[model samples]
Target: MTTPQDAIAARRKLTNRLIAGKDARRLAPFLASDVKVIAGDGSLILGAADVLAAFAGQFADPDFVAYVRTTTGVELDAEGARAAERGTWVGTWRTAGPQSGAYLAVWRKVTGQWLIESELFVTLG
Candidate 1:
C-alpha cells in the first residue's frame, strides 16, 4: 500500500506530466466533475467542462509551456486522500509576456483516484 506521502508525490508527478505533455484532455481523469477553478484574473468558474475549455487553447499551443519552480505541498486529509499543492509556476506564450504566479490546488480522492476539486492562482508581479 502507498503511504500518504507517496500519494502526495504522485500528485506532483501527475501535474508535471500534464504540463510537460501539454495534455489538457488528460487532466479530466484527475479532476472531479464539479471542479471549481479560480483564475488569476479573479474569475470564478465551476464544472470541469468549463474549466477545461478555458484552458484547452493554451494546452494545445505548442509554444505555450509552464514550468514549476518548486514541488511543495501538504496533505489535507490524514489518509492522504485530500491534498493541497502550492508553488510558483511560470508560463510563457508566443503573444503575451511570460507570466509567473503562485498556484494552490486542492485535490480530493474519489474512488481511489486523486482528483482536483479546486484550484486557485494568483499572479506575482
Candidate 2:
C-alpha cells in the first residue's frame, strides 16, 4: 500500500530528478498543469511556458550549476495528496549570479505521477 509518506518522498525524489535531469532545459515535461514558480525577487511566474521563458537563458548558461545539498521538513497532505518540501540549495553560478537560497516546493500527484505544482525561492546569505 502506498502511504502518504511514501507519496511525499516519491514526490521529493521526482523533484530532484527533474532539477538534475539530463534535459533540464525544458521543465514542462516534469511540471504539473498549474505549476507556478515564485522567484527570490517576489516575481510570480505562472505556467510552464512562463517558467521556461524566465529560466531559459539561465538553464542554458554554461556556468549554471545548481546543487541541492539537502531537503528537510517535508510535509504531506494525505487528503489532498499534496506534499511540500522545504530545503536549502547551495551552489555557485556565473551567468545569472551566485545562488544560495532556501526553497519551498509544493507537489501534487496527477495521473499517478508526481509533479511540482508551486515553488518559492528566498535568497539566503
Candidate 3:
C-alpha cells in the first residue's frame, strides 16, 4: 500500500525525469490547471499553459541545461489529501554558473491523483 508521501515522492521523481528530458507535454499531467509557480529568480508563472510556455522557451535555448529538484521532506495533512513538499533545486546552464535553491511545493490529491498546485522557489546559492 502506498502512502501519500510515497505517491507524492513518485510524482516528483517523474517530474524530475520529464524535466531532464525536456518533455513538457509529459510533465503536464503532474501539474494542476491553475498551478502557480514562483521561480527561483522570483518571477511568477501562473497557470499550467503559461508554465509550460516558460519551460518550452527554456528547453529551446541552446545554453539551458537542466533543472533538478530533490525532495528532502514531505508533510502530509491530516486528511492525507494535501501535502507540503520541501526540496532543493539546482539549475544548470552551459554558459552560466549553476544556481541552487530551496523550494516548497504544495501538492493536492485531485480526483485520486496528486498534482502540483503551487511552488515557491528561493535561490539560496
RMSD of each: 2.3, 3.0, 0.8
The TM-scores, one per candidate, come to: 0.80, 0.74, 0.96
| Per-residue accuracy of model 1 over 30-122 as CA lDDT, tens digit each | 779999988877899899998778767777776776645354656566666788877776767777788878888887888877788998878
Residue-level lDDT tens digits of model 3 in 1-125 = 99888888888988888888887788889889999999988999999999999998899988888898999999999998899999999999999999999999999999999999999999999
* Residues 1-125, model 2: lDDT tens digits: 88655666665666456555525455576677678988877889898877767666555767866545356767878576677878876655665666678989887878776677888988785
Q: Cα deviation of 74 in candidate 3 (Å)?
A: 0.5
Better by TM-score, candidate 2 or 1:
1
Candidate 1: which pairs clash?
A: none
Report the number of the highest-lDDT candidate.
3
Highest TM-score against the true fold, candidate:
3
Q: Model-by-model lDDT, in order?
A: 0.75, 0.70, 0.92
In candidate 3, position 50 carries an lDDT of 93
Q: Give candidate 1's error at residue 44 in angstroms.
A: 1.6
Number of clashing residue pairs, candidate 3: 0
Instruction: Give the candidate order by descending lDDT.
Output: 3, 1, 2
